[model samples]
Target: MKKIIILLLIITKISLAFEDCIDFFKKERYLQAKQCFSQINQTDPLYPYALYYLLRTRVYAEEDYSDLLPEMEKFKNTAVYSYFYLYLASINRFKNPKLALEYWSKIDKEALFKDDIPFYYYLKYQIDKSLKKDPIKEAKKISLYFPYDRFYGYPVVFENINILSEEEKFNVLDRLAAKRMFTKAIYLLPYIKDGQKKYLYSALLYMKNREYQKAEYFISLLKGKYRASAVYSYIFFQRKMSEKKKYFKELLKYNDKKLIWKAANYLMKKSFYLQKYKDFFYYSQFIPEKSRYYSNKLWFLSLYYYIHGKKNKAAEILEKNIRYFSEKPKVYYWLYLSYKDINRTKAYKYLKKAASIKKIDFYVIRAREKLGLPLFEGKPMFLKFYQSKTLDMIAKLKPIDYKAAYIEARYFMKKHGVESIAAVFPELAARKLSDRKYLVRYAYPKPFLKYATDNLTYAIMRRESFFDPYVVSFANAVGLMQIIPPTARWIAQQKKDRNFDIVQLFEPSKNIEYGRWYLKYLDRMFKGNIFYIAGGYNGGDGTVRRTLKRYEIKNIEEFVELLPYRETRYYVKYVYTNYKAYQTIYGRK
Candidate 1:
């Protein structure tokens, strides 16, 4: 009995010693943990953890590249990491890159950790490249996902072609042409058989190479099948009008309203005086309900009456057309003239309406001066919508300058009704009153600042450009909110400003004005779905649309999680980071 009791005591002592070592290791006392792990030779899960630390400490302690290899191997075999990349990528294997490549080759390239895939594929590609005897063939092995390879001179053409068709295909084809690879792309069209697609590509190719006859030939072939398509017919008409007046005159025989309109325009251009006015009426009556040509037709019709010296008749046409077209600049231009000639009061009313909306368009300016309309100098148009939870989240993640936080708070209070802004009001006041005179320092608009109290947006701003107004991203976006040039120009056009140049978009007032409009536009494009809108803003509207349709995202959060673009994924993270930082500093509503 005494011998058995002594044995139990000895067992208990050893067990306690092991537990003590684990405790020390948990405390990160690596040297002590290493010794304890060595004492046990049974090879347990804890064995790996201890060994990983042992190698890591050895590498740190000795700073020897030679020792790094074996230690890495042992550690990989022992320790459990989140990805266990160290196990697969142990430095000891570097001496035999062939063996290392062989080992890495066996790894499921598609089953990599989310952040590690790009690097993994890049590494594999590098290895394959190193081993390749034929550099030309190896060069073609590059990932189909990325564009811009002057070496191969391949953009996303081959990859994009496999999936898109019709209008979508044409969009891609245009992009390919923009890259100056249209002639090369012609050879690729043989793999596709859609008639419209074939005709379109053929026409583009012929047009670029100055083969007008071939272009006409290809377009004629498509007319029988795609005659109902106004756009296609219109395209054909334009080409034919330039090259063959006889054929252009023959095309007017078609009874289709859009085609008739095209014919009438052609007749008018060719000085067919007897038939021009009659054909114009036929064309005018056939304009589609949603036709972009409606305003132009109204203007032309009203002008015809005015030039024929039918004053009352012209006024009636102007009134009817103005009501039909709403505030369109073209209609307004004619109406302003009609009203000035007939009744100054009516002219002033319509001109004021046009000027108040915008005074920069050609027609609007004419109307404004004729009626002596007041300038639209009131407080700027703005938008508001922010959730506290969303704002709080932003504050935790984003970085916001002093004045930005203040302005964002004000916006939340006014637009989103986020009561959280009150808590941070003092900070906002301090910053606004600060003596700092730097450009863009205190230049943040009140509404924009308030809206930006979002956590992610503020955090993202820091990493994006340190809030520099002039920072232009690789994608050609500028200003604090990073508005794209094309998008800015579009917004300016919508607001009736023809002079809004894309180059001057970095100006603070212009940048924010257009940036907010773009955000709103994106929001609308995604159906007020913030996640998709955010993704759309970062990746592309088309990409976000495709992804949403691909994943069939019914919920914004799920869509965000499923985004294929890592840039978009990180952008979401960064936007929320900015929002969180804003919420934190501003003390969320």
Candidate 2:
């Protein structure tokens, strides 16, 4: 009994120590994390994780390369061996190209971690370029297939593609234009042989730079169908229309499927802005059946019909098209509301159907409330280790061995519905498998809560950036709370924190601090209304205020459904949903 008690105490200490080490690593305090990792007992279950962190710590710190080769050699037979060698190769790429190339060739590309995949391709491009190999082919491959956005801006391959034939160059330029890399496309315009493509891109380039006169010069160069294209009409739409009849005639002449789709999408927003529901419904029909926006068009058009006292028409359209939408609970709820005046039986049937669905979306919650159903609960699952060859291997070797095996088995497991063996790795499982438990503990760490001037701050953090301290949005909103630089500066000024720098926003504690302050500020401005606070947080305060003034909002949900910007509308729903979920989970209500 005494021996068992001693064992339990030791295990407790190790678990707590490992947690602290992981926390340090996540916060980017590499040196502290390394020190914490170094203190773990070699016999502990997490000893392998400590070693992995120690190696990563050295790499992150830019320490001497001498220890790297020796350390990598020591772990050459381990599961993460490729990861180690790849790190060494990446750091040595420019400094010692020969040695880097050798290591790169030795490392197994398929064994790389998810974060390292993109970097591997990036290094491949750089190394092949240095070796005078066909770097263009490598770059093209990466640019076409890499799943993530470029961390280092556009790859150097674009510059080298200039040496290819004019037609090939034009194809590449066209791809760049489609991706909205306007500057890059313009830079390669001299290499395009096609006069029309050149003129179009030149006009786009000048328009992007806000040089309207120069843009008009290139626009004048377009003739015939190109003149009636969406491109010319778009420019005219931005400028004053001296002759409305002529403008509408040319704009309505867009027979190109792509242009018609674009014009219809634009008109949806324009008609809404002008409060012309009839015109909005007219343009919505032109949206292609295959377009991603088609379902949105259906929902809004049905909504217009319902608002204009055409309930039968709304029900007809919704019944015909509800299957196209992925948000079934929301669609069913809308169907229920639409049928209330027409068929009482169908209304209750759809209401009960929507309530029974398990999704945690806004409509699911509302449907449950209407039917007196309980809130959705996520029960944690556990699987005990079994007596198998795989388990035997995992028991005798490093946890990373199990991690590598699990990664390789993902497709098999996914297809066969076998449980993820990733949960078998103690360190990795602690981060990924537990869902809400780990998310709350790591993301909404208790230390940060003391800084919250508003209780909803942590909930907002989850919705904003999912507590990823390194996250950055397309709009350049950085860190956990997704605060843009200007907002961070404003918060700093309000607090008289003159020493606060923008880079500090990446710290979880600091981000939560600033975020809470902003939330409190918004609360005061919005007069403690959570819906308005959430809306103002996602869409600007000015936009929310203008929207409120523009419409008679008898129902918040209805108003949200009609929001002009799709993202902002969803943002309000997501933020509030997250807030409610948090309240329900923690018994905070």
Candidate 3:
């Protein structure tokens, strides 16, 4: 009895000391963290973690960690050892290229964390270049894996541009344009041919950068279909009514269905807003029935006729196109609304069709509410059995290394998306866990439940980072809530938090708190409208205000459909759906 008690006490002490070291590390008290980590005995199960963090502490403190390399290597074949090798290689890449190569050779490239693969290729290219070896292979690898990586990918590809194929060069250009790296992309254009493509890219780059005059210079140089498309885009951005109408009229001469659909859609919306029924009808004819925008075109046309006291025409349009949108609940719901007073039997038929689709979305929710049905069907009976079986399988298989699973899961989620979590734990797949409740719980985890329980918070976090607190976006938005550094700093100042560092935004607790505060700030700015609040969170308050002021937003659905920014439109839909899903799953509605 005494022996067991003594062992328990020793384990407890080790756990507490290790946690203190972690706390010190998180607080950036590197010296204290180093000392605490060093005190951990090698016999403890956390010894590997202590050694790893001790090395990390030195690195974070900007101190030489060459001495820790020998100690780190003692845990050969371990995840911590692999990470240390990569870190040392990265830090030594410039200072001691040969030594960096030596460390790099020790890493198993295939076993590397997905995020680390880009850096691994980067270090390989650097080593190849230093040794005067052929680096084209490494450069191609970098370009293929991380084409938009400004720091590593751009440099390698640019340096090796002379040897690259035309296709590879164009790939780099496409990625650069997509990422808005116009300056670097411009330098590559002089070397590549294809005048039409180049002019279009240049015009698009300037246009997207909001330099309308610069875009027009390139647009003037373009001709034929390219000119028509560029002019349409330029007018769309420039918002000159005369130029818009001129280019939109010219666009109809081209046989391109995409451009025609775009022109017609814009004109249709404009005509609807202006109450020009004849013009609206003319433009609506150009919208191809096969285009993706056709359903939206139908919805707007139906809405226009309905509001203009032509209810029968509205129902007729929806019924004519109902086959194309059989799976879309919004169309069904809208059709129901059109027939509610005109034809009660038809209205209930469409309502039942919308509500019985077995999907959870805005329209489905509205349809269910109209029928007084439960928002969520009750949890499936198989979910409990599946959970039990998954636990048993995990215990039996022991497929995942729990010690390293969290870090691996974060990287996996970032690379493959949250739906791919089951890949990290084979037991989940082996048990064939297909319960919607479990899947939703995994994808939209509420790790910061202690900070906030409102569905909005989790919904935002799920959309932003899928609960990966260390994830950083291309815009430099850090952590679970994807708060940019400037915004986080401003939020900190607003709360009078003197010691708040931007680095703290990577911490889940601080990120969630700051994000929640920003949401409340948006709530006040947008009068607690979830659509505007969500749109403001993603597209900024100015964008939300401009959209609300510019459009005749009669309701939430129309506002979402008419949001100027496609990203914001999808963002609002996703976040709102997430909010509704959370409410349904947690019984909060």
Global fold similarity of model 1 (TM-score): 0.38
Candidate 1 vs candidate 3, lDDT winner: 3
What are the C-alpha RMSDs, in order, of all predicted structures?
19.4, 8.4, 6.5
Give the Cα error of residue 236 in candidate 2, in Å.
12
Best by TM-score: 3
Give the alpha carbon lDDT tens digit for every residue of 11-97 in model 3. Answer: 855665666887888899888898788888776555666777888888887877667767767765444566778877887877888
At residue 488, candidate 2 shows an lDDT of 91
TM-score of decoy 2: 0.67
Candidate 2 per-residue lDDT, tens place, 1-589, comes to 9999999977855565666887788899998887787787756644544666777887788764454355446444334566666776787788887788888887766556555676777787788877778876767655554412346225554545555666555556556555556666676666566677567667766666556676667777876566556254553345443332244446666566666666667666567655776767777877888977788788777877776678788878888998789888888888888888899899888888888876667777777778877756565455554343333334444223333444433322332233333333332232343353122222222224435534377567767775456677767798878999998998899899989999888776688888778888889998988878878788778867887777766567766776666788888887776676666555563
Candidate order by decreasing lDDT: 3, 2, 1
What C-alpha lDDT do the candidate models reach, one value each?
A: 0.50, 0.65, 0.73
Please provide, for model 1 over 21-138, each residue's C-alpha lDDT reduced to its tens digit, 9 standing for 90 to 100.
6565668876666556455443442333344445554544554334334543453211132123433443434454465575564454433333344454444444555555333332
Collision count for each candidate, in order:
43, 0, 0
Query: Which predicted model would earn the best lDDT?
Result: 3
Worst 10 residues of 1 by lDDT: 436-445
